[model samples]
Target: MARMLGCSSSYLHKKMKSIQISARKRFTPISDANLEEHVRRLHNQFPRSGSEMMRAYLHAEGIVVQRRRVRETLNRIDPAAAAQRWSQTVARRMYHVPFPNSLWHIDGHMRLIRWGFVTHAGIDGNTRLITYINCSTNNKALTVLSYLFGPPVGTGYPPESDRTTEGRILLWLF
Candidate 1:
């Protein structure tokens, strides 16, 4: 303890600060070539992060650094501006559309049967509702589109906007 050592607490703290400053001053600034290599490796490993994130990642690897320092280093080493350009591409890839019907998706299924007809179905990409389904050998796009908008065999078509009210006809068909 400071009292046992016959020294004030402030004196101990001051000595600690001096030692820390001296140690820090001894650490050489990362070389331009080394910084570039490290940044390149970090970018390749984590392409989505900006300079700030990369700096934090470096610190986690026990390298002492600041965000602004990392940004400057990155700009100098990769003067061609490769990471920034590639980041825009990655940004575009990260976004996912939230709704169905925003995009209609249709796929066919093969069944074990004499005819093995195509099972065509249309889905609203946003709502994930089965807009229509048809098991036919024809599998014509026009035919399926027509049936979807056409009047039901007996009952009327389900509401276009209402997602909760299941179509009685579809339940029966399945």
Candidate 2:
């Protein structure tokens, strides 16, 4: 094309560079003061909200914007509020234990079902054996402690529970 126009290749390249338009030089579509303040308020209300959530918020507020536009506007509002991208440089190590009973994992099932009672259980991290299991009307610290190392249980004396008993058990067992 430049040859057809009878211009030198270097001169044509220089002119093209001088006339080239860039997105950065384009005017922003959203420059409203209320939009910025609204973005700030949304971030404060939902600190963990991302672009998708903000888009929903804007839609609910009768404002519609593309996700990219929402993100750009948000970044303009608060750099800290924007989603940060991070990559894991160091790979995670697989779990390893030399012997059984070396580690135990305690987990609580708040409810088996919507109407079910709470249950707590522990397992040997290495052996996969159930170390302890207990069901309580309410999942509480004292109930969990009694299940682990509380006083012996019987009809006369109900199982006595622990305070920070779970953490101590984990520390020693693991």
Candidate 3:
């Protein structure tokens, strides 16, 4: 209703509250206690009853209620059951690493679908930390090497003595 009237919901709620202030609209502490008890009793009777079903049950008893509120109450009573309700199917294959930095997962993602630069990142398997990250104009081996080593035409060289002065390319055995 507030959106339809081009105003914020909080503003509408405040206006309605101001209007009701004169009439003294009340939902007391006792009302909350009763509601908690009602929700608990209903849940105990029908352990498997979802929000919609619980709302239907209340309506049949001449009590009007919102399904969301009922659902929240049910979840609060049993967090485990609430979690179980939303659990997805198990993965066919699960991956595990014994120690940090033992394995690294490298992936490339395009900025856009057709003609966008790609961002490459290496993530440690166990620690799940980002080992290296860079964006390239194109997803090429040279671009990846530029990130790992240094730029092709740089004044200074890398400090690592083991690095070859000659053109040493990446060779994948597997």
What is the TM-score of each predicted model, taking all chains together? 0.35, 0.35, 0.34
Extract clashing residue pairs from model 1.
99-126, 100-125, 100-126, 100-127, 101-124, 101-125, 101-126
Give the whole-model CA lDDT for all candidates, comma-separated.
0.61, 0.64, 0.62
Root-mean-square deviation of every model: 19.8, 21.3, 12.3
Off by over 4 Å in 3: 1-93, 113-116, 149-174
lDDT per residue as tens, model 2, 101-171? 55556667875646668888866666676767777787776676566554234212112212244655434
Decoy 2 TM-score against native = 0.35
Number of the predicted model whose TM-score against the real structure is largest: 2
Worst 10 residues of 1 by lDDT: 160-169
lDDT of 1 by residue, 82-146 (tens): 46555566334563446544444555565733585767666665666676787877545555545
Global Cα lDDT for candidate 3 = 0.62
Error of 1 at 140 (Å): 76
